[model samples]
Target: MAPVSDYVKIDKNPSLQVTADHRIEVVEAPIEKPGSGKVLVHIKTTGICGSDIHFWKSGNIGELKVLGNCILGHEAAGEVVEVGADVTKLKVGDRVAVEPQLPCGKCFLCMQGDYNLCQDVEFSSVYPYDGTMQRYKVHDERFLHKLPDSMTYAQGALVEPVSVAYHGVERSSVTLGKPAMVAGAGPIGLCTLALAKAMGATPLLITDISAKRLEFAKKFVPEVLTYQIDTTKTNQENAVAIRKIFGDSEYVQPPSVLECTGVESSINTAAYVVRRSGVLTVIGVGRGDINNFPFMHLSLAEIDVKFINRYHDSWPACINLIANKVINVDSLVTHRFPLEDADKAMATSSDPSNGNIKVVIED
Candidate 1:
């Protein structure tokens, strides 16, 4: 390995950052070198996650507030430009996907292969730690997965969110011929739907409050059923409606439900519609405290409620899924903006009228 001083440096590393509430800007900074056991990546593509939008718009998602100009992006793919000492797996010129979560490897959860729940985990785009929106990002060697030649940088970036969906699907135990319902047509929900299809989940269903998103989901996955939720109705009413649509008689209902919308109504509706002894995996990040949750109903039905923090041991599966065309992410990316125009990309993603499924920032 070459000495740190011999590393090539870009004079200005343009980074998209959430400077304050409702403000995101591209700021220039000096490029950084990879430390030991790390690799410096020239980020080629990055997906704007909902969490990034939350922090960019409101400066926080719940209690996780942005204290300063935090760089805003996590779902990213790049090429290794420099490799630090002891980096055995990756080398210069390798294309890779960034797994943004940095967990304490020595922690009990990490040893148990549940590092996503590690207490000391430092995730990208969250406050204090910078993210992959910058031109160059130095990440640990363990967190970067080399992308297949078949996968594009946008698809590589999608591996992060797809990994999250993979985790939820695994927790939900969605299998062949299992009737699965995803309660949100957002990025993660759409990903879960595709994975369910790949898992051979027959009669798949997806729901969302936005008709536009539901329409897009239908076009993207024509085999899956789509439902536009009536926001005016109560959660219980919506649940009954969903049951009616699924034609749930006295004995049949969706056994595996992935709640990708963290809204209270969506969660409650999912809980209500799930079959007895079924699994309800909550993947969306929303309010910590939900009001009027159907505690007694879920208890009586014996539904197993599971929650996903981010993901663990899911990157490879996602990579294979995308690389092998099990999940076609080409349609997922609706808009692209250069890194210099990242502000516009974020704005396009935030606006519902634009009808964007996924907005990507390219270098």
Candidate 2:
């Protein structure tokens, strides 16, 4: 194996606070050898997710804030560069997708095989942590998923979002012959549509404020209904538009709603349209505490509310689905940039007017 000096480190600049500039700097830090149960990775590709943009712009999200400079790219895939002395699962040059979030193995959630919900976790690209935008990263071997030849670096980078969709699918409980309506046509929402179809959804209808996103999603799932929900219109008028868009399926009653945008009105719409006993999956994070809801109607209608955190123990299944071509993961990536231009990529992802379906940073 080559010496660790052959690789470069992208660490946070301690001096620069929230006023950091656009192009992130790559400095040479100490090349600490993997202690144990760890493997160094040569990053190949990493996707710029929506959360990355939030951190870049506001330098904060909820509790996590950028008090210091941080490397920025998390939904990533790479090849094993070196292994820790005690590591045996992975070897040098093996392609892999990183889970990014390492839960404390001793946590109760980890013991239950639901590490996504573990209270004590070290997630990359968030506050107080460096991300995978660098030339190399030393991560725990347990969090690495070996990539098959059928899966490309970009597709592997998508595993993170796919895992989220997988978790949402599990939460929604939509079986075969059912229609799964995704309320937001962002990357995560479209990923949910892919997973829903893989999970046997007959017709997957998607809605978004932007017609471009809906049009992009239509490339894969033809049965998708892309309707512009006019917020200015009356509730009955908007519902009627959705009704007209998805005309004709007896199962397309808009009951099985997957709300990913976390917009208050979208949430209210989910609360209103879903039938009694139908499931409403909330996957996106709202701005602040939600004080208002159609609670009276929701109570009378008896809607099952579910909020998806990340994903748990679903990497293998998602990888297999991608490798087997069950879903066209490549179609989702509409933009790409080099790691050095991460700021532009992040900004492009932040602006919906750009019509970027998925933005990736290539090595």
Q: Which prediction has the highest lDDT against the true structure?
A: 1
Give me the displacement of residue 186 in model 1, in angstroms. 1.1
Q: What is the lDDT of residue 103 in candidate 2?
A: 91
> Top TM-score: which candidate number?
1
lDDT, candidate 2, 1-363, per-residue tens: 433433544342211112244334444433445768898877788887777776767677677777777777678899886787778788877899999998988978899887888878889877666677766777899999999988899999999998888888888857788766788888889888887877777666777778777788788788776777787976556656676665654346655778888788877766655656678889887666675776777777777889988888888988998899888888889899876665566667778888888999887
For candidate 1, the C-alpha RMSD (Å) to the true structure equals 1.9
Off by over 4 Å in 1: 1-9, 20-22
Worst 10 residues of 2 by lDDT: 10-19
Q: Once model 2 is optimally superposed onto the true structure by TM-score, how far is the C-alpha of residue 131 displaced, in angstroms?
A: 1.4
Which regions of candidate 2 deviate over 4 angstroms? 1-32, 234-237, 243-252
CA-lDDT, candidates in order: 0.88, 0.76
Clashes of 2: 0
Please provide, for model 1 over 1-363, each residue's C-alpha lDDT reduced to its tens digit, 9 standing for 90 to 100: 533324655567999888755678889856777878988888999999999988987788877889987888999999888889888998888899999989999988899989998988899999888998999988998999989898899999999889989888888868798688999998999999999998999888999989889989998899888778888898888888888877847355788899998998899989988888888999999976899989999999889999988889888888998898878988889999999999989889999788888999998
